[model samples]
Target chain A: MSLFAVQLRREWLLLVQSSEEILNPLVFLFLAITLFALATGGGPDTLQAIAPAVIWVLVLLANLLSLEGLFRRDFEDGTLEQLLLKAEPAFLALTAKILVHWTFSGLAMTVLAAVAALILYLPVSSLGTLLISLLVGTPALSLIGAVGAALTVGLKRGGVLLALLVLPLYVPVLIFGAGAVLEQMAGIETRAQIYWLGVISMASLTLAPFAVQAALRVSLEQ
Target chain B: MSMSASLSVSQSLKAWWHKLGSPRWFYEISGPWQRLFGVLALVLLVTGTVWGLAFAPQDYQQGNSFRIMYVHVPTAIVSQSVYMLMGAAGLVLLVWRMKLADMVLSAAVPFGMSMTACALFTGAVWGKPTWGAWWVWDARTTSMLVLLFLYFGLYALRQAIPREETAGRACAVLALVGTVNIPIIKYSVNWWLTLHQPASFTLTGAPSMPPSMWVPLLINVLGIYCLFAANLIGRLKLTILERERNTQWVRALVREVSA
Candidate 1:
């Protein structure tokens, strides 16, 4: 197989061996959704009204929580430096790493979000929109979060700093992602929101890898 | 002969930019500029404030509360421009590895942060009289809030990293990333809502308000830009001195000044 495939397999193996990396964000998502329901007295009417916002916010937070480990382990083991030192460019390796990150955190969260939505009383009609919005939106989140993770990965206490660096960038994504679901529930056209979300995701897919690579280089220089 | 002349002109332009990239050169050249900008800012600001607050006609709609526009509009306008300035500095730092560009980026942050805060505060105070609330989720207001958060992100990131050059480079990446997202954030937030009034001045049009109003507003804008420049240069000189304290020239200059 090729080098990209080799890197992909390596990241996959590493994640599988340490499955809790996948479980932590998933647990956070489920628990937060349940607690939100309990705290709000589990009223269907109120929960349904705010379900989209709650789910989207939780997903964004869970994605951030997962990001604290995205590059930290690799950096600690010196794998990141070795990967960057290769004769081949690091973009493909970085892409594999981000893809694996999204698969475990963003994708898994989207699946759990459907369950969370049911628990929160989101209308069945809005379910498809939520799923589709998350499908398109979370890749951009992973990409953007990787930029933050790479920048702070070399720091001793980078977890909180990562959130501060990445959260402002997450605003547009949250606005449209949740806005799309909210619009669908209100019987408005959601095409614009989804389209904007797609534009953001595609833009980040193309741009964020270069930024992540630059950040990693900066981190390594120290 | 014309071709050689054009080539020489380009070479000279390149030389000028390279000279500007030198911290020592900037430190030496900016002393008089800082004084000039300080004097100009003071004169213009005082004239504009008195003209705007006292002499200008009260808004038939807003009464005297309209005078706060003299502060709100300029700070709001300059705050965004400073972010753009830092973004440009970030580009220069990343692409050319210019140390002075990093200094520019670092020095501008606190000033820009305060300007953003001043704009938001003035906006809230203005809003209390106009919108009947101190804060509203209006498009302009929300976007300015996001701008404040972006500034904080850069500030916190700079503080988190211990090594100066590493921190500078990392902040450069973050600043560039923020710059790219700024237009998207503005567009998205604008699409979300727009209760804030349209701009008073546009490049393609004459003043929407009377010249009596816009003239003072224009003066305040110019005054604030001068203040921003003076502040940036002063902070930059201090940063250069601190960073270069171990160098021979800086020591000599310190001795010369103290003696």
Candidate 2:
């Protein structure tokens, strides 16, 4: 197999073999959604009104939680150094890591977001839109968050700082993702928001790996 | 023959330029320019603020509250431009490994954050009487808040890293990344605001201020630019001294000043 395929397969196997890594964010998302429901008094009307935003914000936080360790294990065990030096361009290796991260975290969060949407009383019609938006948006979030992870992996206190660095970049995604579901709720056409989600994901998919690479190089140099 | 001739000419030019790249030369050169701009900023700001506050005609609609625009509008403009300047400086730092660019960036972050704060504070104050509330998630103010967060993120990232060089490179990447998001943040916030509010939340839509009113605003804008320049250069000088304190020229300059 090409090294790229091997790297991809290896990453997937690692994630699947360790079930806790995949389960944590899903559990966190569920608890956060419930907490939002409780905090707002659990009224069906209120939950319905704020469901889209709550889902998006909580999904972002869940994504942040998962992103915290995206590179920590690799860095600690000396795997990251080998990963960097072994790859030719290093871009593919870096991107493969981020893609695996999305599969484990972003994809899991999308499914949980759909379930949370139903629990939060989001309209039945909006569920598919919510799922679609999350599917398109979460990969971008993971990519941006990966950059944050790469930047801060060397620092002792990176958990909260990671959020600060990543969340601002996540603003546009949240705006449009929530907007997509909200449009469905309002009976408006949902095409523009979805299109923008695709655009953001494409941009993130292409550009963020370079940033992630730069960040990793800096951290490792330090 | 032509190519070789041009190459030597460019090499000589680059050699001369390299001398100016020294922090000491920058310090010495910026001295007079800083003084010139300092005086200019002070004089224009005093003249413009006094005129705008005490003399300009009241808005027919907003009344005296409109006067705060002199401060709000200028700082807002400077805040965004300073971020873009940092991004440009980051490009230079990453490509050329210029220490001065990083110093300029380091000095600008706190200033940009403060400018963003001033804008948002004034914006809120302006909104109180006009919009009947102290805060609105209007596009402009919401996006300004995001800009403030971006500044905070960059500042925190720089401080969190232990080494200076590593921190600078990382900040350059973050700042460049943030620059790309600035427009995205802006447009998305605007879209979100309009989608939610569907009302004309703009304060300065019409150019109805007649030159008597706007000319003071114009003066304030010019003054703010001068102030930013003066402040940036002043801070840059201090950073140069701190970074180059070990060098003999800086020590001599320091002794000369102290004596």
Candidate 3:
């Protein structure tokens, strides 16, 4: 458990030092929203109508940008090899890595989403749901993305392939996450969307660790 | 025979089954089975298609365009089922280190991709009449498109790596990871509000279709399964031949075929 904490701390420090990795996606999120505004004539009514989808699409793209590093770096540097050989289970180590990735990438996206929401003129009432949805939903993204990353860890030019593998799985998360914001904005009850989001996150959290462990073993064997 | 003697005979059969985990043994054994399935598949497919396309009732909603279901539903069903089948084979290969399982995974790819393409094309044809558009980003259609991409990725992974064993393991891992998409594709409409309709056919639940409509559909589904089995066996044989060209049995088979 202490090892996991140390690993988490190490990942955080790396994320902090690599400001571009953290900041680039945020930049993409804002730029995409800005482009949408420009393309659609910057009308408040139009922006509000498209805000939930645009935000979710941006989040998906931003997540794609950071997904490559989830396992590629560790696998390349021999760190993953040592971890595989460690006495503590690889799944725990992988879970901690995914958690750290979510904290840095997913949480950062959530913060940027707030600014984008304000710019897009989303109703003030929906802000809490949007934030909460991103908070609960992005970890699921990282966890599922970890499976793709681990599977493609040893392959050459695997970035695009990883996207192909992971994006389809991202549908459920995208559906429920975006639905929560959309429902809230539309003045409907978002309880069902929130429930589904929680369910997706919980399910991924439980299952993805085993998948990552299996992938990491195959990867390390090679 | 006494019970103990019968048990011994069955135990030996199980031992032989385990030995068939070797690619060479599987390749040799499946040769006759492949031919048998190939002929059976051809007969079933021809019969089912003729029956469904010619004899079945036109939909009150869709007219003759609904005839595309004969091709579309079977291909879609096989496309999804084949992925599950391939993923299961991949899991066995990865976990058990069975070379025969690797050959099965390889064999399953081209068939899966062809089925995916058939589904997509037939879907477009069906959509033109029903939806008044060639395409929509409906959940089912979108997920099927993604499934096609997954197949391409698996094929590409196989091509990129030089070592057969390493390639097999890598592709297996990708296949297993990609299995997450299968259920989402199956339940995408139920899980989220989408333009795609919910499932019409289920095992335990009541079907949306009447008996006249669905009986041919079942026949077509079985026909597709037979076709997949036949194609898979053919592909596995070719894969084994290519991979085992240096082995004595392959050499003998090549000489025999050429002669």
**lDDT for each candidate structure:** 0.90, 0.89, 0.81
Candidate 3 TM-score on chain B: 0.87
- Arranged by lDDT with the best first, the candidates are 1, 2, 3
Q: Counting only residues 3 or more apart in sequence or on different chains, how many pairs clash (N, Cα, C under 3 Å) in candidate 2? A: 0
Total clashing pairs for each candidate: 0, 0, 0
Q: Model 3, residue A47: displacement in angstroms? A: 1.5
| Regions more than 4 Å wrong, model 1 | B194-207
The top-ranked prediction according to lDDT is 1
Name the candidate, 1 or 3, with the larger TM-score value.
1
Query: Which stretches in model 2 have alpha-carbon errors above 4 Å?
Result: B1-9
lDDT of 1 by residue, B16-92 (tens): 89998888999999999999999999999999999999998877777888889999889999999999888899999
Q: Output candidate 3 Cα RMSD.
A: 3.2
Judging by lDDT, tell me the better candidate of 1 and 3. Answer: 1
Give the per-residue lDDT digits (tens) of candidate 2, residues B111-155: 899999999999999999989999999999988999999999999
Query: What TM-score would chain B receive for each of the candidates shown?
Result: 0.93, 0.94, 0.87
In order, what DockQ does each candidate have? 0.84, 0.89, 0.51
Q: For candidate 2, give the lDDT of residue A11.
A: 84
**Best prediction by DockQ:** 2
